[model samples]
Target chain A: MIATDPTPADRSLLATLDRVLRGNFTRREALATGRIDLPVGRLIGLCLLLGAIYGICLGSYSAFNGTGHAWLQTLASALKVPLLFVLTLLVSFPSLYVFAALQRLPLDFRNTLKLMLLAVLVDLTVIASLGPVFAFFAASSTSYAFLLLLNVAIFALGGVLGLAVLRRATRDVFTPVPPGKALEPAAPVEPGATPPVLPPALSLPAPSSRTAHQAADQARRLLAAWCVVYGVVGAQMGWLLRPFLGNPGAPFEWFRAREDNFLVAVLRTIGNLFGR
Target chain B: MNFATDENLLRGGADVTPSARACLGVGAAGCALAGLGLGAAAGDVRTALFAAIKVPLLIAFVAGLCLPSFFVVNTVLGLRDDFRAACRGLLAAQATLGIALGAQAPMLVFLGASVLDPYLLTLCDAVQFGAATWAAQRVLARHYAPLLARDARHRHALRGWLVLFAFTGVQVAWVLRPFRGTEGFPVQFLRPEAFEQNAYVVLLDHCLRLLR
Candidate 1:
């Protein structure tokens, strides 16, 4: 922990969140500038707090709440969504870090971890924001599959937004960019034209403009890798931690085989819905 | 257990009492008993009793798979004293999980009495467990934050260690299946069924099955 807390003028959580949500890198850039060093502890704390809040809001919904234990489960539901999100990130971060390093984009694990958490924070916020709507549908809907699909859609949408936030934040921390400027791809170089050389006095992205593109590509690849790992781990984790949504058709038991994973079974059933 | 923890533990020194250990044991056990166990809410007393008996074994089963790799990770990362700390932290997380799950026992009982359909009961069971386990993970992360703090040189390795946790945890969990009672299965201490293939293959099959 820092001896002195960041002064209010330096930055606020809300301001940074707004920046992150909008895919603006100013706040993170500020972090890079050393104007404010948000403690990793604080960042993680905020992430967990957001996770808890998000879980509580979204946990209240049920495709069917007629069961005797539904209310109790709903009470604990607040913890469920955040659990899945944070757990997925934890499960996936290591591989992504490996891939980023392989790309030679030498990422600080702490900063990368911070960005990963922030992305999930964005995700949970979106999910929480949609909680009320989903809750309404869950309350009214009788079709478990339809409600499940609706939630899957919302989660995916939120994930896309969150990954975008992470992507923007990653660029800011992994590669230093000049203050007060956007990371626009450098003007297409004219073949055989002498490159415009600015004096070394000003801080700028030192690497060739091509490296910027490479970093962007690198970040994209890293995200995809993380996403795939997260997807598989998350789905299996969900399966292992089974009975999340409660199977209306079967008696309440714990985990089943890996073969019964929600992802595959749902996808298969959905595919069959069309094929048949 | 105490010696293993104190003499050469993973992350930090172990800090647990016999009573504390018993408490975690009883808590997880009680959950599996009384028709209020984790994974699946027991539909009947017979099932609950069967699960209750295996709660301790279940913990060991998971740890057996995870700890060896975890130790290797700590050594490779050169987190010497942190090894005990890590082990302590993991056990503490498990205890925290047991406590959280125990906290919801009343509600689970309420649901058992009230809900008629198995699906709602099962989902609630899974969701509550998720809440409890996530809470445990938060504690574990806090413990590692410091150990992994000085891990700047090997951020990739540190991440790999964390990945090790997830990989082992999920696979171990997969093998220790029937956390919820599977459909049409009798209440048994362990499922007694063996995997037709390894978990990876099975998982891959699941993926491939989706394409079909």
Candidate 2:
């Protein structure tokens, strides 16, 4: 009976996950008017667990395509993708915070970290959702290159969608309320951003539809920027954890030299086209 | 309501936030020193010295090149407002690459000393450099993300800037070779000044030849 009841933290984590999977966020008004606190640690843990599961699922392709100790190599592939995404996000967080401030998104460091982590979390979930389809294709496709390109395309599609939701959700949820006026205040107006025509009463951080739209608009571009940053960061992480799709002939390798960098890989692909 | 545009796009030395400056500046500088140390661990002391002095120069020069291109691209793209911030942001981000790499310096040196195999050492270098580059890009994107609300095209152009920066950085590295002095070759700062072998083309050839 005691074991049957989930802890309060578990409940919170489950609630956040439910919200995220719903593919929409709390309305800006609701988020601002009502409290938008989240148990960020638990939520992130859920996100990583999901991401690793998906990564492992996707890593099955490496095992399918590679030879000689392919199973062991597949395990490495599984470990690498999650490691790559997670490590890159952690390493680059400070800069992300600085950038957030620069944009006057001005996410408090803690919230900003949570928002970014959540974004990545969302991305991994979306990718994982496609895992079954990808695994199916990997099983059928004999050409390693074809499968690799297809997986990359799928991952990109997932990333685009995940980021869209994150942008909308984080904007509404994380936009700060004025000091001491969480329940009733005017929309957040950056100092000198708006003309001072409104009455003193309007200065409070109240939930206005117009302000909600404005806030969402403000975060749209920043989210767009994050998409690119995450993409590049993810790519670099992937390169380091190479042999994602093993060449059919080569024995399984967990890591490859820098010879497979974007520049080299791209050029080689192009060159093969011209030479053959 | 207009967004906050501080009249001075470029904050001066005095105006620069100490934390931001320290994070970026020390990071970039440390990466340079560590790069040499890592290179030295791979081969000989002279090679290490060459790497130490030059990798930082490579990072700075590449970042310096990015500034003008960023300004020109933004101006051409009708994003004049973002030019100053973009420039400064990149400078800081470039420093971040150094910081990220510098942080890993100890681990890299340990690997270099312990692993005598050149192939393994090369793999280590690749991993560290790749991770560092990713971290730097994350920083740069952070600085520029909010500007995305103003113009979506800027994101496209910013990405272009990244590709340009990366291609140029890699080429510069190739041109100034012997960062890790080949064990058998005489220790020289430069790779004996030969005609630049197109690294990409060479890679392409290797793969194509392997198949044949």
Name the top lDDT candidate. Answer: 2
Clashes of each: 34, 12
Segments in model 2 whose C-alpha atoms lie over 4 Å from true places: A1-16, A23-36, A170-217, A263-276, B1-212
Report RMSD for candidate 1: 20.0
* Per-candidate local distance difference test: 0.54, 0.61
Q: In candidate 1, which residue ranges exceed 4 Å CA deviation?
A: A1-5, A8-28, A31-36, A62-64, A172-175, A178-211, A249-258, A269-276, B1-212
Q: Candidate 1: TM-score?
A: 0.45
Candidate 2 chain A: 10-residue stretch with minimal lDDT: A195-204
Contacts from the true interface found in each model, as a fraction, amount to 0.00, 0.00
lDDT of 1 by residue, B102-212 (tens): 666677667766676887876777687688778666666665566567565234334544564454445454445555465577766555533222344455457778989
Candidate 1 docks at the CAPRI level of incorrect
Rounded to one decimal, what is candidate 2's iRMSD?
A: 17.4
Writing each residue's lDDT as its tens digit, candidate 1 over A96-188 gives: 777756654434566556666667766765665555445544444344555566567667756765666666655644455443443232355
